[model samples]
Target: MTRSEATPLTIAYTATSAEPGVNIAALTDALTHHANSALFPGDGEVTLVVQGRAPVTFDLTPMRGDQIEADMHKKAEQINDQLNHMLAEVAAHSEILEASTNGLDVLGVYDQAIAATPQGGEIVMVTSGLSTTDPVDLDAAGDWQLNPSGFVAQINPRDIPDAQGRSITWTGLGQTSTSHAAGTTDPTSTRARPNSQQANKKLHTQHAPGPAARQALHDLWLNLCETSGASSCTIDDSLLPATPTTATNRVPVIEFDQVTTNCLGTFTLAADIAFSPNSADLTQAADKLLAPIADALATCPDGRRINAYGHTAEVPGSGDGIGLSTARATNVLARLQQLGAPRNTIGIPTGYGDTRPTVDNTPNGAYREDLARLNRTVELTITN
Candidate 1:
């Protein structure tokens, strides 16, 4: 019923299915679900990544729990706080996945095991899985060892998965400034964020952040998870300048426009939209469709403004596709404010009914669902 302090680990996430715009609350929920469902004997970290967006990570340190009242008085409260904080962040990640992810496919989940420095010796993989009988004990045949040379004579390093069930495939092997490959160096002393996304599927990675950037992002995640609608909230200690600058502290919002790392444009939604019976009335479940739009708002709050555009192709349906498209646009816009988008930032809804089609929608005995679906998307564009 107790855990050792040496089992500290970090869990990070990257969301590629949805656009960068997202509410921290959604990420918090997703991460919470992931952590709760995850099998861990001790504490760890959690993160969220969106395509073309800045990543968010949370470090949940381990806490020792004892039945003794005195022990509970000192560690339980703080430990509870840490757990609650992690749950919030994790839940946010789950929200994006469940609601807006296009294909339910993720880049990867990067996990780095943290071990107590040996008594001046090389570090080895630290986990309970080394023992055939007891997978959670570190005193196994080859556990509690950090092979500085990245060579494990007793076990095939390729076969070993981290605390989470993530493996390090050949494609995932690399030492970059952003992420560190497993066992390449003692993680206790080094900080690396290797490419954990979609690298052969055996393992995942995270963006390596410097000490300051890590701290800054950590604070941003906490503020986003803790405060409700923190549009005007500020953190850290920096005065508002006479003129505006990036350094000014305000509630963190999505900046998809300037996150040039991805430089995404005209992002498209998935094909799971739920329209009411022959009408553009978004069903109750259709609320999920707005999640990505909300994410865009949060991801690029200060970048360039956007217009929520709805489109439809001329097809055989009960109602006029143009009217349906217009209805979809209006409904989507009505929910934008609720999603945390700044009022002046998101433009009014516009519908392009077959007027603008990604593919030729001409009535030449050639109307396909795939082409029509592309035209039926609820997309975002920079305001003119």
Candidate 2:
């Protein structure tokens, strides 16, 4: 969700025993390696609470980054610069002075950076990319001046661990221009899980997709140009899964109405199941919206199957929309199952995070959250 209940962005972590030295350079690489995750377009200092050391806060106010890779680098640079300066000051002046420079507030909060400290305090950085500070425009994050002397995309997931004892992996949901290219490493490379990451892993355990579910899902499609309440509908059937015969469904055919192109990517849900930005949990109102589809799946013929498609608006610090989207589709799929849709009939959960945006999310382009809501929808289709 855009606004969390509480807890803000504080992430509590537990590491087993002591390991190697604190890898700040690796940390910087992991945090800014990709445009996705651990940062929100929000405001505030990035408060990193190591196991035992004083809590370290990186003020992100004057520092501006819509959570983009480049901007994150800028922010990371700010952090690195401040830490170095503080450490240098502590070495020269004897004790680091409490201060705020380049939008960082570590001295006053963490006491002061000494020449060295006791070890064993591992790290876990957390961010909704959000903050109490003024909102940021993700589109504009890239426009900042770059430090030509140092802007490298060399850090791989190996540098960071995903806390789950696994790597930073991306289950493909049609990703484009993604960092997921055939890697120098595997999908299971070390990556940070933080708090939200733990929840993401649980979603995949719900159900395992098989040939039966995959085949049945082909029946669902948004091929209706005359869908109800559509503003402008022009969808390429080739781009979508094949449309199954609607005659078998007990409920009225679910048609789609296309919103303006600026709203989001090409595919909009005909049913309009609204999911908040970055949220996987469904609401009671969402249950109402999905009731019909579930009802249809309940009475389907043997081997009948349906598919749930999830989408997210392309936004900065949006993390791997894949996990978020997959979590969403799984949540909706679970509801459909609860409503009597058979497990086999439920195809795989697919999430199309910001990678596939119909609308341009450039600076000032995604100003309105309502407009982005269309992208955060789950559409249903019959496979067989």
**Top TM-score prediction, candidate number:** 2
Off by over 4 Å in 1: 1-265, 270-274, 283-289, 295-304, 316-320, 361-363, 382-384
Measured against the true structure, the TM-scores of the candidates, in listed sequence, are 0.30, 0.31
Give me candidate 2's TM-score against the actual structure: 0.31
- Candidate 2 structure quality by residue, lDDT tens digits, 207-257: 111211111111111111111112222211111121111110011111111
Q: How many pairs of residues collide in model 1?
A: 45
